[model samples]
Target chain A: MEAKLKYYLQIADNALILSHRLSEYCSKGPFLEEDLANTNVALDLIGLAESMYIEVARQENEGRTGDDIVYRRKETDFLNVILVEMPNDDFAHIMVRQFFTDVFHQQFFSELRNSKDEFLMGIAHKSIKEVLYHLKRSSEWMFRLGKGTVEAQEKAQVAINKYWKYTHEFFLENDTDSEMLKAGIGVDLSLIKKNWLAKVEEIFTMSNLTIPTNDFTIEGGKQGYHSENLGYILTEMQFLPSKYPDAIW
Target chain B: MNITALSKEELLVEFEAKINAEQKIEPLDWMPDEYRNHLIRQISQHAHSEIIGMQPEGNWITRAPSLRSKKILLAKIQDEAGHGLYLYSAAETLGVTREQYIQWLHEGKAKYSSVFNSPALNWADMGAIGWLVDGAAITNQVSLQKTSYGPYARAMVRICKEESFHQRQGYEIMWKMMEGTKDQQEMAQDALNRWWWPSLMMFGPHDSDSPRTGNAMRWKIKRETNDYLREKFINKTIPQAELIGLKIPDNNLVLLEDGTYKSGDINWDDFWKNVNGNGPCNEQRLAHHIKAHTEGAWVRESAFVSGFQK
Candidate 1:
């Protein structure tokens, strides 16, 4: 596969995987408004993912299609980060995970707008507008919970600690990403990492929270390997398409 | 008057002045305690309505006939939820915490819209809700954007922006049915028949009988009387029904001499019965709500453990 395709897959896979996770809250959120807001966000993510996949297939020029990349790809062939795949577990966990991912996504896309790759730059420009909204939303919750009550504060702290290790992988790039970076087809994730840290640190300070320092990082997602959660997700997401095998409505 | 009695009258006068001046009452503003109490009750009840409103439409999600239908239904339900959150937050601004408001609901102390207490019954109920229930809500909310309360009005503005498509989506569904098989058309009419009267009741009791109407109006909380709003909704929807080639539920629905449609009498007994927790799905709705809340405990716990709660 072309390095640009691989990079686009990572972007598409992040949206696809995270949106699937968020969609679990569709009927199940604690309140109705959140149910709608989360699902809207999920839909936006899925729509963005589809757009990215279309670009990838077009760029690859190897007889690939969006459906081929989406439904036909195996779990190991997907390249979403581990943080995007984690379960919500609760409102706080969801917020924490959303906060971290959004911070990285926002900064990554901000820089990717200047990418030498035209299609990638266009995608980044659009996706960044959405990522900015997501970051603001998650940051608002962070402030609300942190400043609201002792219980909220304690819970938010716990959620951050548990998800902290996954933050590192967002910046962990290998040879492929590096090659794309040199070609100006990929963003230097390191810049995104620095921006993410600063952004998160500021939110933490305002929320009266502390940042945890831990070096452990899970790196499998960028390599097409995933946690067990992906199995269940694919089963449900792909069930209808696979069964119909050319169904249209 | 003595100190206590004088203060009460003074508070009422101040509240009236603010309302007359068209100023929004914020959380920390000074006014009659009764005004605060009344708004808390009304706004929280509205909040509850949005939450419970999810059930009827939620029933049809997995069973939505087409992917487009499914997506639209999901989005509508989500919008309902978002409206609920905004209402809850708005209510919270009135000194009622989210937990307290929820407790009131679980204990049957707070009332949701009586309309939602009934079952969705069939797929057409989804259309009916969008066409009627949401239409009624929009009428009420459009007026409420001018309400005296700052947070509630501001939240309603945001909600109304997103809710623009809900009623249209429902109407679209009905239109589709109108163009589909005979069975589908009948299903649409049947849903409309069942849902029509209940939707009018969503505006609450007749103005004459309503206890809060005078004060709510004085406070700009209710911009129009229930009867008047009901008449407006009927006038607007009746033509829509005509365009869609579906009959309105009531044969008595007719244009008045002065260019308004007057609706038939609603079944108030049924409305009150549902309001009092005797509706078909009242228990089911509450049970599901409590179940979902409890089931998500571990997730909340994990969030707490992860410091995300902070």
Candidate 2:
């Protein structure tokens, strides 16, 4: 695969997978308003992913469509980081996961808004507003979960510890990243990493939460590798289309 | 004299006069206790139906065959949740809090539309629900737009506007399927068959059999009878289905002298069974809601804690 295509898939897959996970909370939210809010975010992310997939399909110039890329791809073919594929075991974990990605998306999309590729730059430009709102919501939840009560604080810390390992994958530099950066079509993850870390630290400090330093990390999803959880998610998401591939939905 | 200072008979006279004049009864307006209680029951039940309605459709959100379908379904579910809240707010004007309304649902002290107790076993059921179920609901709600209660009538107007799109999307799904492979067409037909009777049952019961609606009708809380709305829905929906080349699943359905299609007899036994909570998914729906609420208790509690308030 070319550098631009791989880069597009990476960002698109991240939004798609994360949005899929979030949609699982549609009716199961902590409250009615929160449920509606989460689904709205999910809808935004899906829209983001769709735009990227449309670009991918256009570049490939194949007969396959954006929906085809989503429905026909195998679990291992997905390029999202494992952080997004992690289960929402509880409200704390859901918020922690969202907070981490929202922080990354905030800086990443802001810098990507300057990409040499006009299409990608437009996507980033339109998407930055959504990412900022997502960041605000997740950050507010982090404070509530981390500073609310002893039990709430404990749960939030546990989620932070569990998901902290996957954060490094966001900054993983590969050949595609290097090439895309050289062409000015991609933002520097290392630069985004610096800003992401600062934001995380600021939120964590205000929330009175501990930041873990043990650097065990998970990777490889960007290269079409993922956790077992991705398999289950894809199974359900792809079931109907896989069952009746010839039918138009 | 103050409104509340008036004698009970005077208040009833005033309330009845407002009904006669088609005046909206606001939250602070003096109403009879019977009217308030009835409105609470009806509106809260409507709210609960919207909330429980999320489950069957949410079932299809993950597997919604296409990106457009998935987005539509998710947005529709979100809208349903919003509708639920709107209704809850409207019912609260009658002195019932949302939490209390929810408790009634959880404890079986209240009831929602029993149509949801039927399982959505196929992808085509999504289309069926959007088409048939929403089609039936919109017919009733369009009439509800004229209800005497101010908040509920306004909520109905808002809901009816958004609801038509839901029915159209559902019909589009069915039409697309009917235009697809043999298997796809069969799937659509099967969904229609399963959902046909239940959709009819959504009107509660025939006007002749529903003795309890007298008070509701007299107050204009319900502007149309159950039978009239069901017939209106049938009359409107038949041509749409015929245009799509889909069957109505009613063998005895016939075009009458008035040009309205009259469907076959509904299974009242089954209707009563579902209403009494013996339907296929009754326990599951209530259990799922209770579980979500119970599990989310700590999260709700966190918002009230001193640290969170700080």
DockQ values for all predictions? 0.14, 0.74
Candidate of highest TM-score: 2
How does candidate 2 score on lDDT?
0.91
Q: Per-residue error at B232 for model 2, in Å?
A: 0.5
Error of 1 at A198 (Å): 11
Residue-wise C-alpha lDDT for candidate 2, range A1-249, written one tens digit per residue: 577988999999999999999888878988898888899999999999988898899899988899999999987778899999999899999999999999999999999999999998999999999999999999988888777877998999999999999999999988889999999999899999999999999999988798898999989898878999999999999998898888787
Candidate 1, residue A151: how far the Cα is off, in Å: 9.3
What lDDT score belongs to each candidate, Candidate 1 first?
Answer: 0.80, 0.91
Models 1 onward score TM values of 0.67, 0.98
The native-contact fraction of candidate 1 is 0.16
Chain B TM (all candidates): 0.93, 0.97
Candidate that scores best on lDDT: 2
What fraction of correct interface contacts does each candidate retain? 0.16, 0.68
Per-residue CA lDDT of model 1 for B1-310, tens digit only, reads: 6545457667677768887999888888776777888888988988888888877777665445443565677777777777788888888887779988888887888888888877887667888899889899998888888888899899989888766688898898888777776667777899998888888888888988898898778777888999889888888888999998988878777688998887788879998888888988889988877777765554454444545443
